[model samples]
Target chain A: MPVFPRFTALAESLPPTVPFVGPEAQERTRGARFIARLGANESGFGPAPSVIEAMEQQAGLSWRYGDPENHDLRERLGAHLGLAPDRIVVGEGIDGLLGLIVRLIVEPGTPVVTSLGAYPTFNFHVAGFGGRLVGVPYRDDHEDLDGLLAAVKRENAPLVYLSNPDNPMGTWHSAAAISRFAAALPETTLLVLDEAYSETAPVSALPDIAALADMPNVLRFRTFSKAYGLAGQRIGYVFGNRETVSRFDRVRNHFGVNRLGQVAALAAIEDQAWLSHVIALVVASRDQIGDIVRGHGLKPLPSATNFVAIDCGGDGARARTIMDGLVSRGVFIRMPGVAPLNRCIRVSTGPEVEIDIFEQALVEVMAELNGL
Target chain B: MPVFPRFTALAESLPPTVPFVGPEAQERTRGARFIARLGANESGFGPAPSVIEAMEQQAGLSWRYGDPENHDLRERLGAHLGLAPDRIVVGEGIDGLLGLIVRLIVEPGTPVVTSLGAYPTFNFHVAGFGGRLVGVPYRDDHEDLDGLLAAVKRENAPLVYLSNPDNPMGTWHSAAAISRFAAALPETTLLVLDEAYSETAPVSALPDIAALADMPNVLRFRTFSKAYGLAGQRIGYVFGNRETVSRFDRVRNHFGVNRLGQVAALAAIEDQAWLSHVIALVVASRDQIGDIVRGHGLKPLPSATNFVAIDCGGDGARARTIMDGLVSRGVFIRMPGVAPLNRCIRVSTGPEVEIDIFEQALVEVMAELNGL
Candidate 1:
């Protein structure tokens, strides 16, 4: 039968695709479960004991919708960040929030700027809204900030995205560099400063809340999914000038944020001691992963994020083989999607037991793939 | 202090208004919590005990993202509905899914049809996507199916929304009449047959799964939120022709649904005995609400859904006064937004304790407002 004949031209033109193939999908396709799940950059360390307790206590309250305004969590986040609640908007996740921001600025054929392979989910959102994406290839394994600014100016792009303590490549730029980049952009350009990894990054890497807090065009995105170990809860928030953040109120699914997510985030925020403990483990886990990969004859990149992206000697080909070999042996890891960065594989930090499994799996997979 | 300079014209033109003010927001403003929590139509009776147990059991697993495919839930739902898994797409909520479906078909200036004073969140999404909404007025407090069909034909609307066992007035048309309505629309018009109240509805009020399952132009939206009492879990699913269902995969936040929500829903679906228990309680609660309204010389609309809409024997102003009185006295209830429908106040069914509070509060509110 013919399909419903009138989907929008843009929706029609778009392909049926997902931004990432989750590990569960791979297990189904390959007919085996991965004992070690280090892909997807989820915090395998798990949420804090207090967050779990909060979720447990409120498990029966699933009958009530979450506070539509996400009132308490937003208030706490505002106080924590030294900003007013009006400046922050919590959402389902950074992925869901990114889609809303794209919808607000991107009409069909509008130009948007981002690095070639910084964050595919952001690009997926841009494409979903029919925005024309201009991807500046990474420079020195870091997002090409100057190049992104140049593209935005040339195209008069109203939207651009940059991730500090960047993903996939696991590299970062100094706070001063990012602050300068934000200043260089025309006020007409909205910059999505994704800081999903901010909790794990060096103190010098994140800008002070006041530095760009008043910039109407800058919205810094943060997530409890990362260092806070609540990826499964789908809680993330963005903040900027009150008026700019207010634009989201017009378009957001007001009750879209999950209920237990609010509980998890509130508990996670209050349990900063657990977060500090996790950050310490993450640093040590990164070094252990670096050592393991180095033993396998690959070079580990310096990382400010939870994951370490290691160069696998050859290119995307070798990285793919190693990744496939690891998966076949019940280890799940990921690699960057494009060239240069694609020569590396990324492994997320977790408890020592999972890291130990990854370390053993890597030795065998490297031997099998590289014919050691 | 100017706003972000380059939001799309449509975005800038849209008001920074949420479709519904949550009771939480109301409490925040009123500086007192409502003792009776019945405003948003959420199930105050809560989910199955098994569902709560499941959530608590998996509470620690929430550090991982939910399966992007929503694989296990879809498989179970497919079995329950007697359809292939590909026919179902699970999402954050029916609200979020409505946003996606509207985005797929409703480009700027696209004509969309809905009943006047229907789901405001759906209309919010239509306006967010720049669609022109053409609303057909309700007939005798039930959505005018014939009017909606005619409007779709008149405007050549690609999308139309109807909530069976309707909200606000809580009335429903017979299954045969609804099936005929779906059959009469041009194959081009996609019908969002929201069945959030299906579990509470009489068997005669629901079309069998096979009747509309093959129609590419028809999609039925069901939720764990309403009858299953998992409103806070934010899990809803749409099922139809496989091809149309697949369209959602293209735009949905694949990992957007929360982890524990999946566990909660899976458990809720399995515990049909508890569902029957809730439905029985809802029927009694509905009768209780009806009796209370009638005692006050108001008319309670006959309802197939879990809520009763009580007519205050006057106009919108009188109903608003009655509603405000109830809310001020810690009785949370909502009235329909548009005129005609606005003469009635809506109350959701809940546990006996909350129903008793509603009953007592209604008497006091009426006496205070109407000098009864």
Candidate 2:
């Protein structure tokens, strides 16, 4: 049969990749479910009881389309962030919102900058939109603010991404440093400050909302997926100057955010006690993971977010071997994609049960690797 | 503050309107909630007990992201449609899927065809992608098949859309007529066959899945929103020749579909008994709505969807007056945005209570309009 012709030249040139293969796909290939699911940085601790109740209540209301304005949730978020509701735009997820943000700014050959080992989904969006990606390598296992700013200046890229308390490497810089970096960027550069892990990071590591509130070019992305345990709902929001944030309205799927997600997020936000509890558990789990890494003669990078990146004390190939070994042994975790950073195996903080499974599997995988 | 300076020329050219002025937005403007929501074609009958149960059960499991592959839902849907799983790609909703299809085929200045008074969301997407939309006006009430094919040929449009059992005006074309239309389109023109209202549509109005399955350029979109009462869940899928459907993977937000939505859709598809029940309810509600329209001295168009579009026996002004009167009485409904079609008021089928409210509000609105 003849195939449909006329896919944009960009689409035709793109490679077919099943990016960010989920643990489920890995499990399907391995023919068994993993005992530990510490990858993807999802909160294994689960949503609060109040959130569960809210979801149960709203499950029937799922018949109605959610408020296209995402008014109620945005109002609650604004109150929490000390910003006006118009300054925020809720979306399917940070991934979904990032796609819209890119679409608004990126035409073919538009230059976009980010750390070499930053979130691949953001890069995927950049590539999907035909943005020319300029990646700067991390400095000292952290997203190098200086390097990213330099690249933005050099490329004159309109869009640059920075994820503080960054992923994969699980390292962070102080709020003061991040604020300085934001202030240093050229006014033409739009900094996509991804704060997906901000909930689990230390207070000192997070810049106050007021610091970037006046900067029209700086938009911060946050999600309920991390500390609130709502990744499955795919609810996230981005906030910046009201004028800049309003641009999402032009392109976003107006009714894309799930109704139950809205309910769950509202309840989760109101349940401060639960968030505090999860944060504490995350801290403990990170420490536990660090101990296990040390016991294996690996170095665990100090983390502000809910995950630790353990240097496997070898090269990228060795880390891949260990990750595969862990998967085969019913443990699920992830690693950075690019080299240097790929020398580490990233494990997310989760409940004790999964942590125990990870600890046990790590020992077995090490023995199997060393013995072989 | 100076806004982010380099939004694409296309983005800057777009309007700042919220676009979909949802009922929630209406209520906010009116300073009150609508007593009845019949505007969006959402099933006021709600989802089945079993689907709700499935969502409730999965409510606590909201910590994990849905499978990016949408493996299980696609597999189940394949069995239901007699197509291979590879032929189906699930997304946030048909609205979202439409956006992807447009992006895949549409470049700036690309001509895309749809009925003038058809789904506005599809037009919104086409505009967002900088596609020059060529609209064919509805023939009588149904989307004009001949006109669409002519537009495609005339402009050599790479993409053309047709929604059978159409919206705004709840009328339909026979399956045979549609099959002919599909066979008639140029192979280079990708036809988006929107079957969102198919479940409520008579089988005679639906072409057999295998009839169009072999055509690489014909993609059919279906959803759980209208019939299955899962509108808020935002789960919809598009199916076609596997090769054509595969393009969606290149640009789709892979993890955009929510996990509970997957659960709800799986259960909704399995609960065929509930689907039968909802269809019966929709039919009965349509009849009741038609009676109300006649009582108001209007003519309800023959419907193959879950709503009735009643011609107000005057111009667009009369329809607007009645619709506004209904809105003031807290009866939520909608009408087409284009002329001729805008002469009608559209009401979605819902629960008995909402139907009763509509009936009462229509009588009051008529009396008020006549008195004035």
Candidate 3:
């Protein structure tokens, strides 16, 4: 039978493909689990023990819906960020929050600017809302700030996205430079500053809360998925000027965030010592990955985040082959989708045991590919 | 400073008000804890102990994002329902799923039909997407199926909503009546069949899966939040024609469901005995509530679901006063928002301890108000 024919034209035009094929899907397809999960950049270090305990303690309370307003978690997030509670809106992770902000701002054929090959999920949301995406190619392996600003101005784009301590390439810009970029944008343009990797980035890589707190055009997105090790919990928040941030309330599913996620996030924030400890481990793991890749005669990109992007000394095709070979060899890793950046493979930092497996798998895969 | 100026006109036009204020928000406003939690229709008996144990066991693995496809849960759900896995789509919750389906079909000025005093969250989504809503008033406390069908034909509405074992009034239509209603709908009018209360509803109240499974335009939404007592986990599913259900994947946030929630829901489904136990408790509690209201000259509506809506034999004003009086007396109960239905106060079935508190509070409030 024919499907319902009344879906919006834009919905009909959209493709059903998702942004990422998760590692779990890959295992199902391969019919074998990977020995090391270094893809997706999730921390194998896991959430804090205290956070787990808190989740366990409240497991029986799952019958109660999460607070629709997310009062307590937002209050805690406010104090943590030195902003008022009204400035923050917690959601089902940065991805879910991205969809909401896009819905609030985007309309059919509206131009949205972003670095080419940046977060695909953000791009997916733009397309879902019928926004025309203007891609600014990277400059010298970094998001070209000048190019992005020019596109925003030329297209009169109302939305732009940038992830600092960036993903896939593991590149970053100084806080001062990021602040200058934000200042240059027209007030009508809303900047989505994704800081999903902030906790693992160097101190110099982050802007102080007060620097961009008053910018009505900027919403900084952060998540516990990275250094905080709660990607599975799906807790992400965006904070900015009260009026601008409050626009989210106009369209968000008020009770969207799961209850135990709120509980776990609250506990994760309170355990700063655990965060610090994880950051240290991530730094060491990044170095270990760097050393391992270099020993195999590959270039490791400088990284501020938990993952290292190893230059495979070839193009996107070569990178794909190596990544596939590693996957077949029981290693789970990823690579950039677009060219230039795609010349490298991205591996997340995790426990030494997992890294050791990645090292062994990489060695065999490289030798096999070289022989071919 | 002003907020960003380029938000879409529809978004700017939307009110920032939410569909419902949570009980937690009420407690914050009153500056006191509720003595009896009976509002929101969440199960007070909580999730099955096995579900809780499963959540705790998997709490440490929360660093990994849940399978973007929800493969395992959907597989189990498909087997349980005797439907193919492709016909089911799992999402953040029924609220989140409603938002997605609405986004798919409801463009600006799209006509949608529903009962006057139905699920407000569904209406909230329709408004969020700029859909024009046509409300058909309930006929004698039950959804007016004939009125709804006439409205759909008049408006040529692309979407219609019907919740069985209905909310606020605790009434239901038999399987035959509902099946006939679905058959009467235009092929182009997609039906959103919400069965959130199905587990607590009598067997005669629900249609067999085969009865409407072949209809391309009918989507039945079910939830773990009701009888399974996993409201806080925010897991809900919609199953229907594979082609129609697949449309959700075009825009859904793949990782929106939290990891532990998926684990908890899976465990909850596996423990069918606990579900039966909770249903029994809800029936007894409903009877207890009926006795308490009848003892005071109030009339209890016949209920197939886990709540009782009591008629105060007056107007909305009287019902409001009694509801407010109960609130002040530390009993948390709710009433419908529209007139006619507003003359009745709704109390959710719960543990006897909480129901006992509600009974005592209601008696004192009635006596005090009568004296006044």
Clashing pairs in 1: none
Q: lDDT tens string, model 1, A212-309?
A: 99999999999999999899999999999999999999999888888999999999999999999999999999999999888878999999999999
Every model: Cα RMSD to truth:
1.0, 1.0, 0.8
List where candidate 2 sits over 4 angstroms from the true fold: none
- Taking chain A by itself, what TM-score does each prediction score? 0.99, 0.98, 0.99
List DockQ, one per candidate, in order.
Answer: 0.88, 0.85, 0.92
How much lDDT does each candidate structure score? 0.92, 0.91, 0.94
**Which digits, one per residue and each the tens of the lDDT, describe model 1 over residues B230-262?**
889899999999888889988888889998999
Candidate 3 residues B1-372, lDDT tens each?
A: 877899899999999889999999999999999999898899999999999999989999999999999999999999999999999999999999999999999999999999999999999999999999999999999999999999999999999999998987999999999999999999989999999999988899999997898898999999999899999999999999889999999999988999888999899889999999999999999999999999999999999888899999899999999999999988889999998999999999999999989988888889987995
Candidate 3 lDDT, tens digit per residue, A49-71?
99999999999999999998999
Which candidate model has the greater lDDT, 2 or 3? 3
Which ranges of candidate 1 are over 4 A from the true structure? none
* Candidate 3 all-Cα RMSD: 0.8
Model 3, runs deviating above 4 Å: none
**Candidate 3 at residue A114, lDDT?**
92
